[model samples]
Target chain A: MRQANLEEETAVLGFLEAMEKGLSMKVLSGGALGVVERDGIQFAVLTSQALLSLPQDLLAGAEAAGLPLGVLEGDGFHLDLQGAALVAVHTKAQTCRVTEQAAKLFLYGRNVLGDSVVWHEPGLKRGDACIVCNGRGESLGLGVVVGPFKGMREAVKPVQDLGTYLRDQDE
Target chain B: MTEPDFPVARFAAGPKIREWSRKHGFSDWMVARILQLTDRPADVLEGLLHRPPRYLRANPLRASVEEVLSRLEAKNFSLARNELDPNILKLRQAPISPGATIEHMQGLTTPQDLASASAPLALGAQPGDIVADLAAAPGVKTLHVAGDLAGGGLRERGAIIAVEPDADRMRALRFNLERCGATSVVMRNHTAQELPGKAWADRVLLDAPCTGEGTIPKDKNRRHGKPEEVTAMAALQRELVDAADRILKPGGTLVYATCTFAPEENEAQVSRLVGKGYRVEPLGFDRVASVPLVPGVTQWPGLELDPSVARARHFLPGVHPTLGFFVAKLTKRERAI
Candidate 1:
């Protein structure tokens, strides 16, 4: 694996810390980190390569933090509640509840618009990652904040679902 | 373009290929080279005109082979296991587009060509082995290596260093790696030559860029390539192969592959590495059942290749159900210093 320089390591650590603070939940601490650029958009990718080699103490710390530690597929990490890592996050992380109609669209790989959001955890800003769920509280998938949570239908954009990769026709 | 009135049965292979190239919109030089490379020029030409079957690799990191199959089958998509690689599934029919399926969205499966998938399998990377994939952009093989490293678990200790020179391709590579849940990979937006020499790997896969003669059936634009382009590609491939050799530990495996029918880019290149002390390891075709693998040719008209080149395997599009590909497995030997 390509070793990250000290500066990169610090920047990645800072980003993770900021994400944790923003989401008010624990996030991935140690893993193989790399930068991916597309259409001028850069994403920080954390792979399980480093996680698998982590010492027992570090692994324990990640587990305690309730950070979802699954492998990143395509270009994004997927969160599955069936797995132990995501199970902790599902119970602890803030969730945005959507109606049954929106849940179907969301699961079918569509972004969740503000009009579809029935309720969301307060303090979620644009770009914050959160768990998306149905009114029944079943976890649908992970989504990133794209617009503020306001009363339904004020053109409040939508959440960028991590599963968008699946819906993309272009490979 | 006017069609040449050459009779298929009466005319020699050269005339027949020339006539076919004129009828179809292919360059005469490509047809002539293909004829020299294969006995069944007509079949090869026909194969180029037809579309190959769509293949999807079941990502073991996300779900079991059984689960992925069952999910797709339930979605009304007809599927069958690939004869060569069980992880690869051929689509017979689909109620919806393959890419738009919930299974794909969930990262349980990925669309990949059979020949492309074979490169990583040939490497035989065991769990926890350090593997390097040179020219990994649009990283399909890198993800395959990562899946093998994961050992059917959600996580594994193996690491893959993926190097891609092009920025545009690197973006796609990162997207695919992330979507496939290939978390064992570390992608570098740099050429293979930029990798540190001191940090060697247990296995290295150099799927070098070439003239892509074998992919013409899928992409017609490849037929328009000039001869000088082949020479330029061979030069780049030489540097990539040399870099792969440098980063491979002694006794480590290196699988060199290309999606082209050029002997210079395939056999001649492998032969040069063989002269540099790498031992040619014959590929085990028994695992690759039903696919007719043509043994590598050692005597291309102008090229005097080592007889050891015969150890490499060639998949002709007309013969194999997939695109044309040449795969040569070599082992970095301990120097006799």
Candidate 2:
């Protein structure tokens, strides 16, 4: 089921709050992968590897703590985020997953929070992308990165009131 | 008991298909999908269809490999040691179902998960050390460790405490212990998390509870699990970890491992432990490339994993060419208290 926009905003706020306390977070937004925060903004807006690389135990643990769960079927994956759920596909990679349609909303929310966020499409590797699927289509491995640095070591923390941080900034 | 929606029978041939893909280099993703559908990979499927079935290794703890091989040979059952577990002998030829053999029904052998045996071995165990297998029910790995302990000649000095909370499984655990002849061990039905004191043992193995996502090939019933169940299991895992931390002795080693592929459960949990102050050891995958560790979580092919988290390990089916699994070893330091 798609999450409401309010849930997306709340989740984003929660994620940022958790990152501020030294946790790292990966959020699925608008069919892209991003590290929401790492070590209290020390490494913000960083690109990350596909979510598939993380250990299953950690992901299952996090999903219990409220991170989204992505399901892989014949076509791609399905993700459950706070915002409206999204469907992502790597045409070239023959991969797809569900995501939170919060990328745009989060970008807009971050603008309201007044934090400087950058937008960049991490270049694709020659043989890394899937062939059965086109560049538009992604492999089950397609993902986005969002953090303060390139390789952050902190674990992703679940934030309790990111909405408060966003609200305070909005005011 | 009510029947499982998806049954074990559905996964009987998974091992055959997986073996074929490895020899041919079929893309792992493709192989997994096809297996889910029960479509045999064309290359090796034909051979498997014509071969007679065989199973061996009737509890290595009780009988010698040579003895078992001789017995099987006498019975005209072709037995070949599994490359993964030398104790496990695959059937090259057999006149009857191996599990029905007198050796098997008498608790001489069980169809154990081969990957499960690797976790305790990864600990670099020596004789005379105290080792604990957390969540050890039906004690497959516990027996494996017992076998290792015997092989390591730690019989006089080494001891194993097999812990499991489930009542039903504890019975099976006892049965396995007896059959495996791992007598230099303690069996406890209590939860590992509930252990009374800190820094309790020199080593601890937590085959933590997981969604069993990777077991889909062998445990077909796993595929139908709902998302909510995954979330609940995750929460339980965190609690179990918290308990594990409290009981592990300072400077002691712990193997936090699982049988799932979700990042949240594997690498993510390791990250949490590192945040709590355990030191991860360096684990290299080059030596075991065919069954390489998961990236971002393994000690080798090292990257920016939490400095403390670096001591942990993670495994996958595609990389490992085995059942998807994860293992991380952490050495507890002196507690501040």
Candidate 3:
């Protein structure tokens, strides 16, 4: 729950910067925000999550390694649906806006075929991270680019989607 | 998968008992217990085998009650407003699972049971209070508390310290909070026993883990637990409540809730707190109570509990339309100087 050190700060921004050029601290910085780890996954948390209700002693203390509210959260960066949504709005990241039919398929844990991708970022290439969106430009999930954005082959591999919660319930 | 062998040897399986148990898919012991607890055993038995009416609550962080209602209505889904909470809508009928709908994907709404949705609000979390949610996993109640603290995610400056010890459930909790945009929470992975003590929280909510007998309708496996499992769970619940008491500020509200009808887990646990002189308070939710609630039981066979347990309410499935749940509210006693 401590403030994100310079190294952690740089690493988070660096991961995002690759997707959207010039994505720096100015665009990413919200007051009193920092990265914290839980179960080996990284999250950017608001200061409230860091501040314990009681003061902590070195020997015994309670702290929040959790985030306050959303904080444009990430869990493993690429596989985080919330983080992808945050990235889509805040930065001009690589995105593929899918058609209604394709959005339904993707939500069912299917990869995005070229025919279903109505529009995609012109700069997308193989192995790049992409945010999958619906007709309203709302994020559906995060994906990994499989081929050229305009190519007819399967283009984005679905890594995470909003339907995950539902699928988990089914099990 | 094949069904697990249901334990059925405890009760005397009379002809009538055998017929009723076979009809309701309950073991002889469960049928005998139900008959003991309710005059309308048929109603209770039927409730255990079928799902209750589906319900969903509008997420203020993503959409308004009016907006959610309008959208769902446009989808031709019949809906009704829950008598307890207006923002919660009961699904009369739907073309698909509510979870697959666009509204859910947009975080505009969350599908939760009417009873489960009401548990956290019992704490009455306000804008500035520092609330603690012990055993908060899968984030349903945590999301509600966070929204209340944020005044529906519109403003900030409230905090919820949510603790869950399970790793897999913890992941689901984080994802749920992020999806709903409820930002006033601080997640902690520590067990209830591990929380540091300063009696600092303004309110504490311990939705203690229980046998989940209340969820029998949707999950059949709940009916198959061994008799001793309830006792073992009650032991764990006691440990959890002890931690909740430790972190609660003097005079702070402590809400203890469970989803089982076991007297040991319900009345016995709360009665222990009352014995410590924690004053029992009315839940104050009587007016909006969606279903009839009986007073907490004072005696379970051989055990005669204090009358103070009556301050709590029980939401029995046959008696109430929802699950068989119990909720008790208490105010921590001030320390003597």
The best candidate by DockQ is 3
Off by more than 4 A, model 2: A1-171, B1-60, B82-85, B92-95, B105-108, B152-156, B283-293, B296-315, B318-321, B334-337
Candidate 2 lDDT over residue span B1-337, tens digit each? 1211221112233665456656644333334432342222352233222312223445655566676778668889886665546777666787876654535432346555445655766665555566777788777777677667656331223556667788667766654554333444555567766555556567788888887766655554554455455456666777777777876678877788888754455656676778788777764332233433434443212122465553454444433434556677777777687
Q: What's the true lDDT of residue B191 in model 2?
A: 71
Give the per-residue lDDT digits (tens) of candidate 1, residues A62-109.
101111233333434433332222333434445678876776677666
Docking class of 1: incorrect
- Local error of candidate 1 at residue B220 (angstroms): 1.1
Model 2 interface CAPRI class: incorrect
Best by TM-score: 3
RMSD of 1: 8.2
Name the regions of candidate 1 deviating beyond 4 angstroms. A1-93, A96-104, A107-129, A133-157, A166-171, B1-13, B286-289
Model 3 chain A weakest 10-residue run by lDDT? A57-66
TM-score of 2: 0.51
The number of clashing residue pairs in model 2 is: 66
TM-score of chain B of 3: 0.91
Q: Model 3, range A42-89, lDDT digits (tens) per residue?
A: 556544432433344311222334333123233223325655665666
- Please give, for residues B110-140, the per-residue lDDT of candidate 3 as tens digits: 8777777657767888878888899888778
